[model samples]
Target: MSFLLRLTSRLTGRQVGTDRFGNVYFESRRLQPIYNRPRRWAIYARGGREPTVVPPEWHAWLHHTVAEPLPEQKRYPWQQEHRPNLTGTPESYRPAGHDYVGGTRRVTGGDYEAWTPGA
Candidate 1:
């Protein structure tokens, strides 16, 4: 976070809510002429500011897709916990046969064989 952003957020932002991960959500105190509506933002709790860290409910709220924030009582038994995207990280998933996994895909014998032209 830069000094200017911190100052702007402190002066114009109002704390709206905090997520389970401790990330703080905020909205502009008043509508801005540039946006014509109160802008929303979130400060990441973790060292890296990964957008995926924001849960689906908060994400929807931040993008104005929902009028109200997620309610605690609305959660269901099947709702899965949020997990940060690990696409390019060391902890990312690699299925079997992946070089990183040190596994080779098994080649099963089949009836079909490659045919060369004029062979």
Candidate 2:
């Protein structure tokens, strides 16, 4: 965390809860003059600050989408565990022919040609 964020967090934040991943959630103890509502925020448990690190339940609460945070036991058996988004990371999904994976796409035999404007 930067000096400013650390300072701001200390000055205005109150711990609301922590998620299973160790991400700590907070809300402003009092509304500040700059905003219409008290602010809510989170500090990432992992070194990276990926938003995906937050579970679905916490995501809803953080955005005020739900009135209350999800209870630990409320999750259904069919539901999968939460995982952070990994679009650009090494762990991200890559199709079979992706360049980064050292795979080459099969070339199709020439069956058509591009049309020239005046041809």
Candidate 3:
């Protein structure tokens, strides 16, 4: 976050909550004249500037979909914990045939023939 933003937030923002990722949520103490509602925003945790790091519950709150963040609800046993996007990182997923994996795809028996334009 920039120093100007930090200063603005501190001056006009009222902290609403903090998420598990350490992100802090806030709302403008004074309502916006155009919208007649307090503006909402977040201070992303270190290394979490990617918007996807904001969990679903917090996302809804940030967008004004709800008056307040929904209470934490139980997750299904099959549900997995949230993780930040890992694209471009070493931990990102790579298919078996990707160059980083082995650049060569295993060939299976022919399943069909290529189609001709008019045949």
Off-target runs (Cα >4 Å) in candidate 1 are 74-77
Which is the winner by TM-score between candidate 2 and candidate 3? 3
Assess the local accuracy of residue 75 in candidate 2 as a C-alpha lDDT between 0 and 100. 69
Ranking of all candidate structures by their TM-score, best first: 3, 1, 2
lDDT of 3 by residue, 1-119 (tens): 88888898989998999888898889999999998999999999875368888888899999999999877678899988888888999999999889999899888678879889988
- Model 1, poorest ten-residue lDDT window? 67-76
lDDT of 1 by residue, 10-85 (tens): 8889888988888888898888797688889988887456899998879999998887787654667898777999
Which pairs clash in model 1? none
Candidate 3: regions farther than 4 A off: 108-119
What stretches of model 2 exceed 4 Å from their correct place? 2-11, 33-35, 74-78
Q: Candidate 2 on 1-119: residue-level lDDT in tens?
A: 56677678878898888888998888888876875667788888785567879888788888878867887766689988877787888999998789997788878789979899988
**Model 2 Cα displacement at 107 (Å)?**
2.7
On lDDT, the leading prediction is 3
Clashing pairs in 3: none
lDDT (C-alpha) at residue 114 in model 3 = 82
lDDT of 3 at 25: 88
Model 1 CA lDDT for position 104:
91
lDDT of each: 0.84, 0.82, 0.88
Arranged by lDDT with the best first, the candidates are: 3, 1, 2
